[model samples]
Target: MNTDARSHVHALIDRLPPVQLAALETILQSMLDPLSRKLALAPIDDEPFTEEDRQAVAEADEWLKDNQPVPLENVLADFGLGMTDWETMAKTPLPEETGKRNG
Candidate 1:
C-alpha cells in the first residue's frame, strides 16, 4: 500500500473501539490467510527440489503430453454440477471454523 493509504488505515484503526478493532483484525487475517498459505507453499529460490518432487513434476508433464485437456463443463457435468454449482461451492464456507466473529 502507498504511504497515504496506510496512514489513512492507521487513522481509521486508531478511531475503532476495542471490539471493532478485534473484528477488523479477524477480517484482515481472513483476507490474508489464503495469501499466507500460497506464500508458505511456494518454493524458495535457495532450496533444491527433492527427488520425489522431480519425479512428480516429470510424471505430471508426461501425463499432460499424453492426454488432451478436458473441458471444464464436461468435467462438471460428470459430477452433475454446473457453473452455478461451482460458483456456490466457491462461496460456501469450509467445514473448519476460523473463529470469525458473528457480527
Candidate 2:
C-alpha cells in the first residue's frame, strides 16, 4: 500500500489528454488480466509449418468462411461447465483428491 506512489500515478494520469488517457486505460486494463498479459508478452510462433498445421489452418479458414464463431459459454457447456463455474471450480477441492487424503 504505497499511497505516495498511487497518488503520483494518479497525478500523472490526470495530466494525460483524452486519446492518450484512453490508450493508457486500455494498456492498464490489459496488464491487470493474467491471460491477456501472458498473451501480450508471448513470443510469436516461429516453428516451420507442417502438413498438419497447413491442413488445420485451411480447415479453420474454410469453417470461418461458412460458420459463425463458437461462444465461450457454449464451449464450456459441452464440458458441463458455465462461464460462472470457473471461480467455484478453483475454490472447490476435487473429490478424488479429497478421498485420497481422507482414506
Best by lDDT: 2
Range of the 10 consecutive residues with the lowest summed lDDT in candidate 2: 94-103
Candidate 1 residue lDDT tens string, 1-103: 9999999999999999999999888778767776544445558889788999999999988998989878998999999999999878766655553557565
- Each prediction's TM-score against the native? 0.42, 0.48
Q: Rate the local accuracy (lDDT) of all candidates.
A: 0.81, 0.82
Please write out the lDDT profile of model 2 over residues 1-103, one tens digit for every residue. 5999999999999999999999998789777765556566669999999999999999999999989999978888899998679756655656764667553
- Clashes within 3 Å, all models in order: 0, 0
TM-score of 2: 0.48
Clashing pairs in 2: none
Pairs of residues clashing in candidate 1 = none
